[model samples]
Target: MTAGILAIDFGGTRTRVGWYSNVLELITREESLSHTEEPINAVIDRIIQLAQKVVPDCEVPSAIGICAPGPQAYTGYIRYAHTLPTWDNIPLAQRISAAFSNAPTFMENDANLAALAEYQFGAAQGADPALYLTVSTGIGGGAIIGGQLFTGWRGLAIEPGHIKFPAKDGKIYSLEALASGTGIGRLAWEKLAASNTPSSLRQIDTVDGKAVGEAAMQGDALALEVITEAGRWLGLGLVAMVHLFNPQVIVIGGSVVNLGELIFAPARQTLAELLIDPLFNHENLLKVAALGDDVCLTGAAIHAQKMLAS
Candidate 1:
């Protein structure tokens, strides 16, 4: 029987688990809804269930690799998790490893894992230094330098969302607060409330990021305006990343990407205008992630394989 690996990508709102062969090919998949209110044990159980379903009965995976929301695993304690509050101070590695009957578990930050996946198999392929940004419920970033995931001594590096910058409102806020999917929705609602401008967005009872995207796709002026502002803010954040890391490629992904150029166009233009070095402005430097939803999970599988080799 071929050996397999268990890979888990745990997020604040959902968890994804997959089985992969020792060579890093996915065999099966499962997902579970996660909650900050639920006990951490419950989430572990869900992961275990998925693992069992995917792996063949005779082949208990060679190893297990987990990619979870961070700052975590530095000292085997999750300092504080904003997405899943119940995970705060929890011994994440030990607990997850125990659930699989002590199968060797390797852990890394989820965004870092995603970046690794891209570098190995997706958009950042062939690029030695790359940057990956996920702009969904929140913005998360990871960097690959010298063909390795770049985590600072404490594993807190590449947290792009937390970068504080001034917005049009004259207040400095985290990049996520101004540019994520959630942020895009917030911007639309606040602007709609302040302006009497007639638009289809006002007809909806609730305006979320998806709603805003849909309205913009339909040519609603108000929705388009909100997206443009959000894209510009995101562009500014990318500028900081470009200057700091000088990556060969910057891969952007997540739910917000589905909105298409409503966000990317302005962000790209702004990024080009702000970058001082002409060498950094190549058309291919910034790209959409190629692996889509499976990027982080694939990274986990790759990590497991690495552990087995080590």
Candidate 2:
């Protein structure tokens, strides 16, 4: 009989649970609002409740995989997560293992899981060494080398967003602080407010990265200018990554990428200009991740299967 695994993708806003046969077949699925403000035990209980509702009478899963936002422990304890306030220093893997009567459990940073999903089954499938980046509210990254998740030293190594970038004003800030979806919005708001440009973005009571992208798409000159600036910063970050890792491919994903070639085209152009090495200038090496939002779920399932096999 094929073994079944339980995979959970726990995010700040939503919790998705799936029972899968191997890593690909979704046997059952469930989702619930994530009460990230609640205590870790409360969240775990909710996940257990959802799992019971979905699986009902089946034997306990062979193993469980969890994907959570991080600064996570190398051993699978959650040190802290920006999205979930109640999860600080929580021994999540241990708690979940106990909940299942000591069934094997594995946990990873959500970005790492997403990267694994792409590496194993999606965009990076055949690439020996690939980088996966998610550019949403914040930028997150993971790397796969020789088909294995490359967690260096503390298992906290692949944080690309924190890389520093020199701003035009000479202040150095993290890539996330300048290039993330939220960051992009902040830049546009600051620039638009300071300028006399008549923009539709001024009509929105609240400024956000999506709004900026939409405004740019609609021919708002200021929005387009800010996004182009953001693209340059993003490309600078990618150049640093390429020089450091020299991966065979880089896969970009996340909601901000929904801006499509508007964002990527400029980013690629900047990357080409900045990467002086001929070997690093290949256009085919950088592409958007094929897997959409489902990557973490798929990745968690894959992690669980690997754990069970080990």
Candidate 3:
């Protein structure tokens, strides 16, 4: 009945709260769509409300952890959230800590925490240098080096998605702008409008990544092309990441993972064809993340446990 960890995965699209026993087993969880228009205090209120369900008023968690989007500050400050503009300079971790009794709270970039989760209990468990990329509304990533979470000098070392590249279109775009789910959706729109491709994607009213992915699943030619192009960009980005971090393994997760092989096949093929380092060119070198939607929450718990131990 005692609570060991209370964790929150505060993403741009969804927010989740998890309760875990001392053994790190997920006891229960609650989630809801995230509406960033609400102020930070409102988000806190909702988290406390959700937390009280699994955790009674009388019980206190040993530690608390939160995983958020965008570049994270190690000093417990919210630098900025591309999706949640109201989060700039917010003391998120401190506010969460203040809500509980005698519990220490920790917060970090969701992508970074996800990497930690994979290193501790998921696909990258044994790798000394591993990488995690979460492709959702935007792309974000984290690195695990020498069996430890590699937060750079300011704890903002990894910003893979933000890395910009000059494209054939004579425009520069961040990897996220060209390859994430939002990016894929935008690309689909461009293809549909710029070319008269006879495809099912044109039938969808709002062709987002999910819609395009569904169309691809049904074997739509244009959808396939769109997904393939996104995958290629993703692979090129991965190649850059590999060269920079020299990660022994790369674990990718998030909503885009739902696209299955439709997306990964092309990325893998691209890596095979273009990656400079053949040692990491193998299929096994890159893995699908194991935790699914709970990846960040689990990572948050791990962060809390580490902080409590420290």
Q: For every model shown, what is its TM-score relative to the native structure?
A: 0.95, 0.95, 0.94
| Candidate 2 per-residue lDDT over residues 254-297, each given as its tens digit | 88888877788778888888886979768588878887767898
Would you list the C-alpha lDDT of every candidate in the order shown?
0.84, 0.83, 0.84
Residue-level lDDT tens digits of model 3 in 167-225? 87899999998889999999999989899889987665889988988888999999899
Between candidates 2 and 3, the one scoring higher on lDDT is: 3
Error of 3 at 75 (Å): 2.7
Candidate 2 clashes between residue pairs 3 or more apart in a chain or in different chains: none
List candidate 2 segments past 4 Å from native. none
Order the candidate numbers by lDDT, best to worst: 3, 1, 2
- Candidate 3 colliding pairs: none
Worst 10 residues of 1 by lDDT: 73-82
What TM-score does model 2 achieve against the real structure? 0.95
For model 3, the superposed segments whose C-alpha errors exceed 4 Å read: 1-3
**Model 3 worst lDDT window (10 residues):** 48-57
